[model samples]
Target: TTVLTPDVLIIGAGPSGAAAASLLRQYGYQVLVLERQHFPRFSIGESLLPQSMVFLEEAGLLDAVEQAAPEFGFQFKNGAAFLRGNERTHFDFTDKFTAGPGTTWQIKRAPFDHVLAKQAAAYGAEIRYGHTVTAVDVDGETPCADVVDEDGFAYQVRPRFMLDASGFGRVLPKLLDLESPSNFPIRRAVFTHIADHFDPAEFDRNKILISVHQQHPQAWFWNIPFADGRCSFGVVAETDFYAQFGDLALDDLLPAILASEPSLSKLLSRAEFDTPVREIVGYSANVNSLTGRHFALLGNAGEFLDPVFSSGVTIALKSASLCAPLLHRFLQGGSVDWQTEYEQPLRRGIKVFRAYVEAWYEGSFQDVVFAVEPQDEVKRMVCSLLAGYAWDESNPMNNNSVKRLATLAEICRDGRAARDALGQA
Candidate 1:
């Protein structure tokens, strides 16, 4: 029976919501963020790309993040390492073609998100936890939401502009019927945290390791290490591929799959899988429209391609950084084109990631990554994309990613075949 109005209403105090609130507040807007969950709640997507640091810095939250590094056990990360059978390759973010921060942290999402939300609140943004948006109406001039508190109190919030940053929750997408089937095929991931015990020299704790299944080209594992001797390990494969396992419990399932990847299995042999194994099926999603009226969707609320590249948080923060300024301009009575200024540009970066994700599953990118002799310039460009510089227009890979990646892949494969023929000769 209460009504509250804010200049901007952000749903979900996750990365995107927190970043947007901070950015808008910096621009002198009154921002209210509603989060259904409390701080320090468990969440996935533990990896962070270098590009995320730019947004955190711009939002004035990077200082807080760096300050929390020791307390939160934030792991130092400089690059990513990949493995398949006996071949191995790594991309040092510092060697990338892009001109930006070359290193970032491998984070625990729970603490990372809490830090961001807390910092945003410290910056004068009002953040209400345990408040869920049950209904949304954006058809009118002002976008509003019917929210219910934990104590059963119900209220309505009307804001001049609304942003949905509900990662995977997709609150507005579900409420307003903006959901669309993702173009990528259905996939699933089974994961858990482990008290990883490894010799410092044996494994590179500073880099996330992705190991491909020797037998199943479509299956892969992500080993994301944390500074506190803990690591996140997960396996992703097409949904039907898991059907063969047939209702096996996660505890039994994950270890069984890990046994198939020799390198990962040996590396994790002595590690403890302390947490309960978890599974997420069909996580890839999309939206029919990114914005309407006074509202727009940010991060996973709009579209989610895949987790293979760990692009979730980067995209979430990118969407926030891109939208805050445009929304600020509109609030200042300046004409803004949401389609061209926001959606199109955002989707362009997304498309670049999409092409890589698709190529990843199709095996083309793997060939490019593990090539016997990849060109330094080409590798640097690929490293830029991997570093989450997808929006950089100067990068040739950003334009026509699918075609360019395909051509590069073909060239790598041909060179590989020629080398094999010479070896036989």
Candidate 2:
């Protein structure tokens, strides 16, 4: 077996891997990326939060992404629209208190991920496609990964440190027995892309649409439209909720589920499924630790919460950005505090998103979001969080989101009571 050596070895070519590779290369490290699949492959998480642009710019990939935007038919996204029956509300990212660009893009993940990997390759990171890591040994001073290519050529790679950005593959976690119980219950999503022609008058293509099921409080749907006139549609609900449709094929299950949500049904009335229906279940995961003796986890490799509010890519980029500088320090022989510097700060933002996600399903955040007239400051705070500024401590909502959300929701409930009393008088 041939032996390869690099300063850093990354296990996946997904967003987190590519971002980490790009940033590490900028810090003068020889980075090797291994991917089990080729580029432009099917994956979910197409929508991007505005804060991701900062990390892209830091990695010098912003221009490439900008050029590919029009070439790949990416839609410019300014905000998100939430709908539940007739109660509609929109939170414009631009209106938030964040300092960076208020708008981001909604692109096809396959090509978008390809572009990111390509950008990393251009930056001198060696990305080998079809290389699946079968085993990893991180107990040694130098971490090593055993890999096999599609052609069945096996090899070993030794790197000073490893970054497991393998996403849902969770390569390191599974190999090292690092898996931990997640706080979230099991959830499933049934999704597909559709060729939908949108009437600009009826739909604001500039923002993603999130519609909650009128009957099932635990259920929610996403409508992410692209510039190519195609939209990604999906529904997420508890696993038990989905089991009721057990054994039903996606084609039939999708239509049957969509019929239950009126807003989504009307919006997708003329749309036709352009791709086969796909389903993913129990995606919420966590790890016992984000780092070990010679390696660290990035993005979904470490933890993955629910996809409501589109936090997956944001957290992935955040993990990559957070891990890059500290990894650089370790490579340079500087004593790096892994837990204090890398994991704590990273999980802080994650906890903020987690609170909001839990509140969303509990019906409190939904009530606050769909309020007839919410306080301007509170709405902006919520918008800032939605825009991926969860780490900004200046935003009280980020500092203690659960308490603030509960308070705001109570205010909303009280306001409704007063209005009803006045109407009766």
Cα error of candidate 2 at position 115, Å: 0.5
Worst 10-residue lDDT window, candidate 1: 416-425
Cα misplacement distance, residue 242 of candidate 1 (Å): 1.9
- The runs of at least 3 residues in candidate 2 whose Cα sits more than 4 Å from the true structure, single-residue gaps closed, are 243-247, 372-375, 416-425
Q: Report lDDT (Cα) of residue 375, candidate 1.
A: 43
Assess every candidate by TM-score: 0.96, 0.96
Q: Supply the global lDDT for candidate 1.
A: 0.89
Candidate 1 clashing pairs, residues 3+ apart or interchain = none
Count clashing residue pairs in model 2.
Answer: 0
Task: Let me know the TM-score candidate 2 reaches against the reference structure.
Answer: 0.96
lDDT for each candidate structure: 0.89, 0.88
